[model samples]
Target: MFLTKIDTLGNVVFSRLLGSATNAEAFSLAVDSQDNVIIAGSTTDNLGDNTRISGTDSFVTKFSARGDRIFTYQLDTVAQDKPAAIAIDADDNIILTGFSDGAINAATPSNGGRDVMLLKIDGDSGQRIDEALIGSATTERGEAVAIAEDGNILLASIDNGRAVLRKVDVNDFSNILFEQDLGQINNSGAISGLRVSGSNIFLAGSTSNSGFTGTAASIAKDFAGDTDGFVLKLTDNGSSADADFVSFVGTEAFDKINDIAVGASSVFVVGSTRGALEAGGREGPTDAFITRIDMATGAIEQVQQFGLLLTNNEATGIAFTNTGPSVLDALGLPAGTVDRIETRSVDSQTTAKAGDYFDISIDGGRKRRITLNEGDTFSDIARRINRLSFRGDVSADGSNGKLVIRANGSASVDLIAGEGSSDLLGKLGLKSQRLLGTDALFNLNDDDDQNSSSTESDLGGVFAFKLDGPLGLQDRQTAAFTLTQIQEAINTSQRAFRSLSPSILDTLGDQLGGSASGVVPTRLQSQLANYSAALSRLQSGSGGGGFFI
Candidate 1:
C-alpha cells in the first residue's frame, strides 16, 4: 500500500509505502483534525510485528502530517477480519467497521458466519477502547461508517442481502440507539456510503429490487433497470427516523454508486455505469459518472461521464475539497486529460408495423400471441405484453430503441416467432430465445474464463446453427427474401460477442487484433467474409439463385 500527499497545485508533498513481503491492502482512510492520516485495512503479512495471526488480520496505522509514523495497531484474530470503512469522531477517536469471522480484541463473540465488527480506538494511544459485533446466524457485512451529530456511530451494513442502518451510542458499543432495514424483504441491496448533516442522514448504495419504492416524491419513482444506484435521505427525529426521499438512478445495464459527498447545496455521487446515464451516450462499455442532485428536492442537477472509448472505467471514491469534488477513478489516465467524443442524435422512429405479431411464453407454459395494430408504438406493444397473464413485465427502451422483457417471481421468459401472417420476431431482431429472470446478458461472468472450454463449445454450437439455419446465409433463397434475416443474424453475432467474458475478449483482441488487423482466425474470417458477401448480394439486384460462400 502507498500513500501520497499532494499540495494545492497537485505537486507531491510526501509519499510513503507501507507494506511487508506479503500482501497488504488499504480499504479506507481518514484525516484527523490535527492533520494526522489514519489508514485501516487487512493484511496477510505481519508488517514487521513478527506476530502472524490466522488468515487475514485487520490493522490501523496513523501517520503525522510530516509523514512520520505514529502508531500501528493490529487486531489479533484467529479468523479473517477486514475493515471496510473508517471515520474520525469529534475527539479524533477512530471508529472502524467491517466484517470478521470471529471476535476482535475479545470484545464480542461471533454469532455464526461472518459478522459486522465495530471498534473504537483511542486517537493518541492507538489502543482499542470498545468493540462490538452485530449479525445474525447468516452473513452480514459492515460496508460504511459515519458519525452522527449526537456523537453516535451510524453504520451501514448488509444483513442477509438487505440494506440495514444502525445508530449506536459511542460510549457503549453494544447500545443500539436506532436501527432500520432500508430495503424490502427478499430484495438484495447494499449501502456503501453514509453521511450525516444536521438531522438528515444520507445513504447511497445499489439495489436489485424493482419494487423499491421511495417514501417521498422522487425524480425516478420506478426502478430503471438491472442493479440501480440509489440515494436515500432520512430525517432523524431523536427517537425515530422518517424517510425524506429515495432517488434511484440507473440505465438498462449495471449501475452502482460507490461513494457520495455532500456539498453546500447539492449531493454529489460518483460511480460506474454500463449504459447511457446522461444526454451524452455511454463513453464505452462502462464509464465513470459524477452526478449532482438537489439536496432538498431530490432532483438531478447535472451529470458528467468520463472514460476512454472501448475501455471500462470506474469511480470508486469522491470527497468535497476546497477546489471542488475530488474523484478517485480507475481510468489510469493523467490528470486533466480529456478525450473529445463525437455524438450523434437520432430521433426515435417507429419500427412496429401494422399486423405484426409475436408469441411469448413464460416458463414453457401456454404460448400467448401478441398482435400489433396500425400506428402502434413499442410502448403499445409493451402494454399488450403486460396485459396478458404472463408472470413477467415488458418495457420499451426509448433510448436504445429496443424492447426489454423481464420475468418476475422466479419466472423465465421465452420469445418465439409467431405463425403464418403473424411473424414479427424476425423483424424485431430477436431470435427464439429463452432467458431466466435473473439472467443479464451483458453482465461479464467471471467464471466464464475458468470454464472457457464449455463456453466456447456452447457459443460455437449457437453459431453453427445460426450459420446454416433458414435465416442463415446458407439458405440463400429464404434468407434473401428480406434484410430482416441478415439483421437478425447480426444481432445474434452481437449477442455472442457480448457473451464473452472481458478477460477472454481482451486475450482475443491482443492475439488477433480483431478484424481491423486482418488477423482473425481462419474460421471466423471465413464466416465474416460469407456474411459480407451475402449482404452485398442482397443489396444488389443479382441475389437470385446464387449460393453464398
Candidate 2:
C-alpha cells in the first residue's frame, strides 16, 4: 500500500510505500478527527510486525497528520478479504466495508457466496466492536460507503447485476434504515462509485441501457451508445417514495464513469471513454474525461477530455471538500427510502397452488390482502404483489425457494396467511418474525445460524440434540434413564428419519391418504401419540417430570 500526502496545490508533502513481502493494494482512504490519515486495503504478506498475520487479509493503518505511521492492524479471515470503502462515524469509530467470501469475524459468518461485510473498529485501538454481513444468494460486494448527516451509513453495492443502496443505523447494527434496488439498465450496471450530497445520492458507472427497466416511471430511460457512462441520483432520506433520475452520456463509444463528487451546484464525474464522443466537448479514443452536470436538471453542463489519441488515461477515484446548497431541493425531495424484506424458505416448494393469499401489513398499520391468481408462478405472484404501491416489492429468493418483499421505507412489514391462504407462511417455512422491516440480514444454511437464529429461527425449524459420548453420565445397565440417554435416543430417531427413503415414505403416505397434503395420517398420528406418551412415562420414570438415575 502506498500513502502520499500532497498540499492543495498538488505539491507532494511526503511519499511513503508500506507493504509486506507480497503484493499489497490500497482500496480506500479516510481522515480521522485528529487529522490522521487512515488507509484500508488488503495485504498478501505480513508487515514484518508480529501483529500482522499472513494470508489475503484486510488491513487498516493509521498515519499521523505528519504522515508518520502510528498503528496498523489486520483483520484475518479464512478466505480472501478486501476493503473497498471506509468512513469515520460520529464517535470517531472507523467503519470499513468490503467483500469477503469467508468468515468476517467470530460472530459474523459468510452466507455462502461473496457478501457485503461492514465492521466498526475502535479508532484508538483497531478492535472490532460491531459488524454485519449482508448478502443475497449470489455474490454481493460493497463498492462505496458514506456517512449521512443523520449518522446513518449509506452503503452502495452491486448484487448480481443490479445496483443496491442500503442505509444502516450505525448505533444499532440491527436496524437497516432502508434498502433500495436501483434496478440496472443493462447487464453492466455495476456500482463503480458512490457519493452523497445532502439528501441526494449520486451513483457513477457504465451501463448498456439494454435491459434497463426501472421500478418507477419517473426514472428516465435513455440509452446513448453501446456502453455509455451513466449517472443516477437517488433520494437518500428513507423517503425514497418515487422520484429518481438517470442520465446516459456518451456518443457511440465505450464509456465507463469511475467516480463522482458533488460540488455546490455541480456534479463532477471522472471517467474514461473510447472512440469519438461528445459531452462538454469532443473527445477522441482512449482518453480521460471530466464532465460537470447541473445537479438540478441532470443535464451535462460541461465536459473536458484530456490525453492524446490512442493513449489510455483512466480516472479511478474522486473527492470533494464541499457541496453547496442541499441537492435535494434541486432534484426534488426523494420518493423516500425503500425497505428490503429478504426471506428464504427452509424447504423447497416445487409447485405453487392457486387461491393462496397473504396479508401484508406495513408500518404496523395498513393491511393489504393479496390473493394469487390461477396458475401463477412465484415470479408471477411477485410481479402482482409489486403492483401494489404500498406493498413495495416482492421477489423470489433464487438461493432458497422463498419470497422477498421490500417495503416502501423502513416500515415494519408483516406477512401472514389471509383467510384461505392454505398455511402459506408454513408452506414457505416463513414466520412472522422474518418480517425484516428493520433488519436486512437473511440466510438459509447453518453458517449464519449464530447471528440470525434469533430472527430467522422460525423460518427453519430448530431441534434440540446432544452430541455423542456420555461425558456426564455413567454406564447405566439398569432401569436408570438419564436425560442424556433420552436425548441420545431422540437424536438417533431424528437421524433415522433423515436417512429414510423419500420415495418409500411417499408410498406409505399415499397408502394412508394425504400423500400430497404433507399431513400426518390418522394411523401415524395415533402411533406418534402413543410413542410420545411412552417417552413421557419413561422421562417421569414412575414419578412426575423427573429423570431418576
Candidate 3:
C-alpha cells in the first residue's frame, strides 16, 4: 500500500509510490477490510511509454498488506475529461467518479461543460460498469461518488452554479433519487468538493451575488466576502436542506474550496482563506487550512492549525482511520493527529491490544461490560446503555462500577477499576445496553462466571437472564449486590430447589409467591431471607470483607 507519513517537523517521512505510476495516469485510493490499499484513478500511459487516451482515463492498482503493488488495471472511455474521486463500497466495489468531455450519445448531449461519470468496478477483476452522464450537463462536474448500503451509487456534483446530489441505481445507473442545490447560494454558486456519511452529503463550494438576498431565513444573497469558502450539508438528494447561514464561509477574497472530509465527530474542509469566519466558520490563511466542524451541529471547532507558514501547501484528498492515534504514538507526533487510509479488507476488524490486570479484548471478538455505581437506579443503566446486560453486581470496594457481562465460558464475572469509560464502549452501538437487574445476578446460564459475548439477539442481552434459565427472570428491585451476594443466592436457590423437588411454585411459595401480596412478596421475600441468613454467617468472626471466598 502507498503510505504517506507526515512527521511533527512537517516533513513527509515516507511517500512510497506503489505499483506503476503509468505516465499521465492518476490513482485514487481506498482501504480494504484487511487494511490493504486499493487505488482506482485513471491511467493514460503504460510504463511511462505514452498517454493511453486523449483525456485522463481510469486506472486501478491493488497493493499488498505491506505496501507492495500487486496488480494494476487501466480502464478507459472516449471522454475528454479525467477521473476525479474514487471510493469503495460495502461490497468492495471501486467507484470511480469524474467528468467526461466527449458526449456519450448513449446518455445525452452531455452536461454542457462536463458530464458526471460513475464507474463501478470489481476490486479483484477490475470488471466495471460505466455510468456516464449522471446529472445535468450544464457545467456539471462530478466531485465525489459513494456506494450506499442498498447498492445504490450516490453522486455529488456541481451544475449551473448548484450542487447536484443524487443516488443512481447500481445496476442501471439511473437516478433513483436526487435534489438540486445544497446551500442557499448566490446565483453564482458552484459545488467544488463533496463528502458523504451513509447517504448524507457534504459539499463545499463558492457563491457570489450581485443582487439583494434575504436574512429572514439566514439566506444572504450578497455575501460578505467575494467568493467565500462555504461548507454545506446535503441529503441523499441534493437539496437546499440546511439553514441559509448553515454553510460556513471563509474570510479571504476569491477563496475556492478544494476537498472536504469527515472525521470522528468533525467535518474537515480545506481551501483558500486569510483566517476569517464567514458563514462557513473560521479558516486558516492561504497556507492550506484544515478546519474541523462538529458533525451533528455543523459548528466550527478551534483546534491546531497545520502549515500556517507554508507558501503553497494545498490540502487535496482526505481520509481517516482509527489507528491514527496509534500512528501518532509511534511517530511521536502530537495527539489528535488524523491519518487517512485508502482501502481496507472486506472484514477488517478494529480492536485494542489487551493490557495487563484487566479483561478488555483487543480484537473485535471480545465482549462488552457495563459498569455500575452506587445509587445507580436499575433504570439508569437500562435507559442509558441499550441492551443492558446486568449479570454481575457492584464492586466490593465502595466504587459502584460493577458489571454484568455475558458468560465467558465460566460461572463468574468480575468487575475492577481503571477501565476507560469511553474507549471501552467504542465498539458498542449507541445506547445498545439495557438493565437486566436492579442488583447483582446470575444462575440463568450454564451456572458460571466466565462471561462471553452472546450475539444471539433474543438469547443475548439482560432480558434473557431468567431466574431459573427456564422460568421467569430473577427479581432485582434493590441495591446492586456484588459477586459474593450473587454466589450466595445461587447456593440458597440451589439448596432450596434441590430439596423442594425442583419447585412447582408451591415449593417456592416463600421465594416465588412469598407469604402475601406486596412489594416484599414473592421473589423479594426469598431473596431477603437468603440475604439475611448469608449475612449472619459471613459477618460472624473471621469473615474478612464479608467472606469473599
In angstroms, how far off is 307's CA in candidate 3? 5.3
**Whose lDDT is greatest here?**
1
* Local lDDT at 376 for model 1: 52
Give the distance in Å from residue 405's predicted Cα in candidate 1 to where it truly belongs: 71
Tell me the tens digit of each residue's lDDT in model 3 across 193-233.
65667645566666664222212233322245666666655
- Model 1 residue pairs with clashes: none
Sorting all predicted structures by lDDT, with the top scorer first, yields 1, 2, 3
After superposition, the stretches of candidate 2 with alpha carbons farther than 4 Å from their true spots are 48-53, 185-187, 211-221, 239-243, 279-284, 321-549
Q: CA lDDT of 210 in candidate 3?
A: 24
lDDT of candidate 1 over 1-549, digit per residue (tens): 788876544666656666534578999999999888999988875532335564688899887776666667888778788999999999999999999988665447888888999999999998889999999889898999999888888888888877788898989987899888776513366676898889888888888887664354454434789898988888887656778888887888999899999987889999999989888889888999999988897878898988888899999998765553344333332343232331211111222234557788876778888886654556667777777653344323423545666665446678888653235675565678875543332222334343333333345335421344323345443345334445546655654775564457667778765545545678998999999988887677555787654
- Off-target runs (Cα >4 Å) in candidate 3 are 1-22, 25-27, 47-55, 103-113, 135-137, 149-151, 183-192, 209-223, 235-245, 275-285, 303-310, 324-549
- The whole-model lDDT of each prediction reads 0.73, 0.65, 0.50
Taking all chains together, each candidate's TM-score versus the true structure is: 0.58, 0.55, 0.48
Candidate 3 versus truth, CA RMSD in Å, comes to 28.7
